[model samples]
Target: MKKVIVGNHAVSWGVQLARTEVISAYPITPQTQVVEQLSEMCASGELNARFIKVESEHSAMAACMGASAAGARAFTATSSQGLALMHELLHWAAGARHPIVMADINRSLGPGWNIWTEQTDSLAQRDTGWVQLYCETNQEVLDTTIMSFRLAEQVNLPVMLVLDAFYLSHTAEPVDIPDRELVDAFLPKRQARLKLDTAEPHSFNALVPPASYMEMRHALQEAMREARTAFDEVEEEWEQRFGRRYGAVEAYHTDDADLVLVTSGTVTSTARHVIDQRRAAGERVGLVKIKMFRPFPTETLRAALAGIARVAVLDRNLSPGRGGIFAEELRAALYDVPAEDRPQVYGYVLGLGGRDIRPDTIDTVIERTRAAAAPDREDLWVGLLGDDGAPATTGRAQTSADSLPGVEA
Candidate 1:
């Protein structure tokens, strides 16, 4: 059935269809609606699940970890500060190899306290050993939510479905709410390959000796590496049944193009409109929508952007003095390729804190990026809205870089 739904509500519908057995969440802007709707469904007997109203985002994730470990299909939703609060349990859930699926309405972090869209929260945790999916529309949010469980369970890794806080979270759009029977057929019963709960007692979360700690960590890394194939298989199965397929990084109009724009979340939709307009006016610009952030799809990115002479990466999240978040990752993804072969990536930061990004603004970024391709040229800033709109900062600096490395770009 088709209905106008916000991204968060679409996620709730997906969770309901997936037959989630347990849901734990704490209220936060944008993400609050997801849990709220799910709670209503459970209360009204529309969905059969244990709805846990936890004290904080930290406890919400802890409860999910506990439930999933006990052999239940667990779920949760959060945003910005809430996500940051769950950082500790994020590692615990993955290390326990619990297949918990979560929806994160991406919002900016702050000292001034703002509630709006930005990828920094989720992107900051890129190495927590969880699969991350960035959705471009309400429909993708629904589809990705259902597929996340299959992919996460296959490799025993949790998956975080990240969407722009207000852009997608609050906007209404038509989405095909798949029949429950079809969802059941596609993502049936929840089964954990290895579980902590047992009819026969066994030790779990035991202390690991220093000699074996690194090896156990390596094992988890191997599982994440294997999840790449697991994700592909899940998407293949989904496409076979639903007639829709999304890649680790979805490419648009890249064929025979001189420049490509890379984006995530709802901005990709705006970028697409800009690309189409430019193409109509004879500009050879295209778009690359990055769905997976962690287990960073480097090889796939290299291939999609291999031939393009110039590429522009627009990030909503500011890394303080370092410019856009996604720009750095794209740079690292193509760093090893020969300078001539690697596309010249230009970074532009825009649309933080619920600010609107009209198609013309995106077009302006593309135009300016083309004009400033030289190595010495500074990073670009689009739609800065005020005098604070300084030229974009580039390369990692002490003030901007996170203490933990391996984030790549």
Candidate 2:
């Protein structure tokens, strides 16, 4: 069936179709609607699941861990500080090998006390040993939510599906909601390989001494590696059934282009429009959209951008004192490529705290990248304002949303 739904509801529908046995999540901006809808489904008997009401996000994740360990397919949703609060248990969930699926609405962290979109929250959890997938559209959000459960269960690792806050979480779009029967056929009830059993009570996550600690860590790494391949196989089957497929890294118009812009989340939509315009004008520009972050698609990225003259990465999140998270990772990934095949990487940090990344903003980035003789080690800041709230002099021309039709300021 086809329905018009917001991204949060898309997540709710996906969880419902997956037939998740347990749901636990505390209310947080942008993410609250996801759990709210699921709670309603549970109450109305639309979804036969246990909705655990927890006092905090930390407790919510704890409940999910327990439920998942007990052989139930569990799920949850959170954002920004809520995600930060679950930090400790995130490791426990991954270390204990619980296949819990979570939806993280990308929201900016507070200090300035703002409830807007940003990528820092999720990017900060990069070392927690969970698979992360970023989505661009409501349809992709729904599709990825179901696929995540299958991927997580197969590899025994947690999976997080991330979407932009207001851009996707609040905005409604037409989505093709798959039939429950079809979803059931794709993802049957999860059969845990090793689950807590009352009849055979066995302790899990016992104290690990140095004698065998490294090996356990190594095993986790191996599972992460396995997830990289498992995700591809999972997507292939999904495409065969639904006739839709989204790769970890999707390349567009890069066959003979000199520069390719790399982006993620909603920014990719704006970038695509600009790429189409540039291609029409014969500018030799292309684009690459990265959906999968964890189990970083290093090989796929290398193949897509190895011989390009220049590759610019637009990061919506930042790592203070360092630079853009994605940019730094991309540089490291491309570091070992032969000098001849290595593309000079230009990193630009923008859209932090929900600032609008307009078409003109991307246009400026392209012009600056093409003009630069050498890529800078540090990322350039776009759409920044000075003390007077005037656009800062960042070598980017000031442009408005009105410059392009169908683009809102």
Candidate 3:
């Protein structure tokens, strides 16, 4: 069935179709609609699930952990500050190897008090051992939500699928809602390998002393490695059944291109239009959209960009004193490649605090990357505004060459 829906409702539809057994969340802007719809589903008997009412985001995750521990298919949704509040339990959910699925609407952290889209919130939780996937469209949001449950259960690790706030959360799009029977066939009842069973009562998440702590950590790392491969298997099955597939790292026009832009989430859609324009003009520009942030898709990235002349990573999230989070990680991932094959990575930070990253903004990035001998600095701020609301120079230096013109910062 096809229906026009916002991204949050797409998430709700996906969770409902997945036959999730437990739903727990605290309402936050952008993400509230996700759980709100699920609550209605549960309340109206459309979805037979326990909708746990939690007072806080931390408590919401705690409730999900408890439900998942009992071998139930659990789910939740949250945004920015709410996600930050659940930090501690995120680690617990992953450490205990619970296959709970979550939908995180990416919103900027507060102070100046904005509630617009940004990737920093979800990227901040990169090391929490959860498999992270960023969606570019509402359809992908719905599909990934269902696939996440299968991927998490297969690897026994929590999964978080992220979508941009307002851009996706509130913007309506036509989505093909999969048949409930098909989703059920694809993701049958989750059979947890280990759970808190009444008949077989046993210790769960007990203290690990120095003797075994390191090994347990190693096991978690191993599971992450396993997830990188399992995700492919899951996508493969999903594609076979549904005739739709979005790669963990999708490369476009890169086979014979000299420069390729790296992007994620909604920014990817914009970059694609620019790439198409550049291609039509006979310029060898391409794009790589990264969907899976965790399990990093290192091998796939290497295969796609090994011999590319220059690679520009446009990150909507910053790592404070460092640089763009995705660029930093991509640089590290490319470090081991043969010096001759590695592309010079230029990191451009933009669109933070929900700032617009338009086509001309991307055009500026491509022009600067192609003209520069090497990156002037690690983090090149794009579309920045000055104190008087004039176009500001790049973050590193305020030179005429660094000034961004005809672009919205």
TM-score of each: 0.92, 0.96, 0.97
TM-score for candidate 3, please give it.
0.97
Two-way lDDT contest, 1 vs 2, winner? 2
Candidate 2 matches the true fold with a TM-score of 0.96
For candidate 3, give the lDDT: 0.92
Q: For residues 227-282, write the lDDT of model 3, one tens digit per residue.
A: 99999999999999998889999999999999999999999999999999999999
What are the runs in model 3 whose C-alpha is more than 4 Å off?
Answer: 393-409
Q: How much lDDT does each candidate structure score?
A: 0.85, 0.92, 0.92
Query: Candidate 1: which stretches are off by over 4 Å?
Result: 375-378, 385-409
Worst 10 residues of 1 by lDDT: 400-409
